[model samples]
Target: MIQRRLPIASASLLGLAAALSACASGNDLPSADTAASQVTTIGVNSYLWRASLEAVSFAPLLQADSAGGVIVTDWFANPENPAERVKLTVSILDQDLRADALRVAASRQVSQGGGWVDAPVQAATVQKLEDIILTKARELRRQAIAS
Candidate 1:
């Protein structure tokens, strides 16, 4: 099974992205380009799964997926490095079809050990996660606008 979250999930970041609709409020969308305009950056958060000091950047966020969520799992340089185990789950919410909207009100991570995604990810894994996240962001953006 795959973990689900919108914006950015995975224990690597202290803060990911979540929004009801990219809006500061429940009825307004943030600058359409705000998310996409922003450079795609990733960092570990203070969650139970603390990743090393490795950082990465890919694409920007640009979507409002209310159905599916984006997930990023992280691990230490050493695949089995217990010290580098970290994972998080992010959820995306699509409530309305208007400009009015609210970004993710809260964020959460499902910390556990199972599969690769269920567990922590390595550097290469990070790249894959980043790509998925960026794509999701853009898809959501288009869907939001269409709504």
Candidate 2:
């Protein structure tokens, strides 16, 4: 399954890059009315998708499906705290750039007795991640418009 998805993910990233470059070249800039939101050639808002990827980029990705608007990150243990690890899943639920269009879920684990054990993730952590993604998405939209 991952082998099949590699091509699709690569193609999607290439398409997004091409689209963004086109936008940067001032050939396909959206009008003022639609520029604030709804800049998407894929299944979800390109800005949000890109922002989510950037937010979790420090971790290894397990799956990324642009058509399905899902990004799953493999377990990541911060260098400062190897005993604790986290995995993230981000879902882009809409084609428009809106606060409700993004969802972030996290699973946490802590090392116990030389073994990993599930730990509860704080609600604020999830909310903060969503906020970061949304902010970056909005910033990307603004830059796209400015360019």
Across 1-147, the per-residue lDDT of candidate 2 in tens digits comes to: 999999999999999999888889966766665455987777789999999999999999999999889999999999999999999999999999999999999999999999999999999999999999999999998887787
Q: Name the runs in model 2 displaced over 4 angstroms.
A: 1-36
lDDT, model 2: 0.94
Which residue runs does candidate 1 get wrong by more than 4 Å?
Answer: 1-121
The candidate scoring highest on lDDT is: 2
Alpha carbon lDDT of each predicted model: 0.32, 0.94
Query: Clash pairs of candidate 2?
Result: none
What TM-score, computed on C-alpha atoms, does each candidate reach?
Answer: 0.24, 0.76
Please provide, for model 1 over 1-147, each residue's C-alpha lDDT reduced to its tens digit, 9 standing for 90 to 100.
255553244643433334433554566744454323222222211110111111212212333122243333232233454433343333322222221111112112233464233433355654454345445544555654566
True-structure RMSD, every candidate: 23.3, 18.4
